[model samples]
Target: MKKPAKILTTAMIMLFSLVQMPLTQAAMITTGEAIQAQQRNIDRDNLLSMLQKDELRAQLAAYGVDAQAAAERISHMTDAEIAMLNDHLDEMPAGESFLSVIGLIVVVLVVTDLIGATDVFPFIRPVS
Candidate 1:
C-alpha cells in the first residue's frame, strides 16, 4: 500500500509538472471600428450573393466576363473598395434603371481586365 501510494503521488506530480496554462491575448477595439467591420462583412456578403444570381451570371457572360472570376476578384478587394461598391449599389434607383447597373458591371469588368486583375475580354491586353 505504501509503494502504490508513493507511485501514484509521483505520477501526479510528473503530470502536473508537464501541464501548461494556455496564453491568451486581449486587445481593445473601438465600437466604431467594430461596427465598421461588421458592416463591411455584411456588404461583402450582399455583393457575393448578388453575384450568385443566374440572371446576373447570364448578363456577365454576355459581356464576356466570368461570374466566378468576378467573385474571386471581389473577394480580393479591400474593405474600403467593397464599401464604396455597396454604397453605389444602394444608391441605384430601382426598376427601369437596371441598364445603368449593367453598364456599371461592364465598366468594372473592363477596368479590372485592363488592370491585369482579370482576363475577361480578349481585346484588352492587361498592362504588362
Candidate 2:
C-alpha cells in the first residue's frame, strides 16, 4: 500500500511538472481585409456547392471526370484560384455558356494533377 501511494505521488508530480499552458495570439484586422476574407470563404463555398449540380455532374461525366473527385479537387483549391473562378463565373451571363465553367474546372484539376494532388487525368504526369 505504501509503495503504491509513493508511485502514485511520483506520477502526479511528473504529470504536473510536464504540463504547459498554450499560447494564444490576437491581431487587429482592417474592415476591408475582414470583408475580403469573408468573401473569399463564400466564394470557395459557392464553388464547392456548384459541384453538386446534376448538370455539372453530367458534364464532368462526359469528360471522363468523376464528380466526387472534382469536388474533392475543388476543396483543395487555393484562395486565389477560388477568387479567379468566382470572378470568371460572375462575368458570365446566366444560361449563356457552361463551357467556361467546365474549362476552369479542367484547368484546376490539371494543375492539381501536375502538382501531385490528384490523378484524375491520364496525360498529365505529376512532378516527382
In terms of TM-score, which candidate is strongest?
A: 2
> If scored against the real structure, what TM-score would every candidate get?
0.70, 0.74
Alpha-carbon RMSD, each predicted model: 5.8, 5.1
lDDT of 2 at 23: 58
Maximum-lDDT candidate:
2
The models' CA-based lDDT, in order, is: 0.79, 0.85
Question: On a 0 to 1 TM-score scale, where does candidate 1 land against the true structure?
Answer: 0.70
**Can you tell me which runs of candidate 1 are displaced by over 4 Å?**
1-26, 96-98
Residue pairs clashing, model 1? none
* lDDT at 118, model 1: 74
How many Å off is the CA of 97 in candidate 2? 3.9
Residue-wise lDDT of candidate 2 within 25-126, one digit each (tens)?
Answer: 788999999999999888878887888888888888888889889888778888888888888999998885477788789888888899998999988899
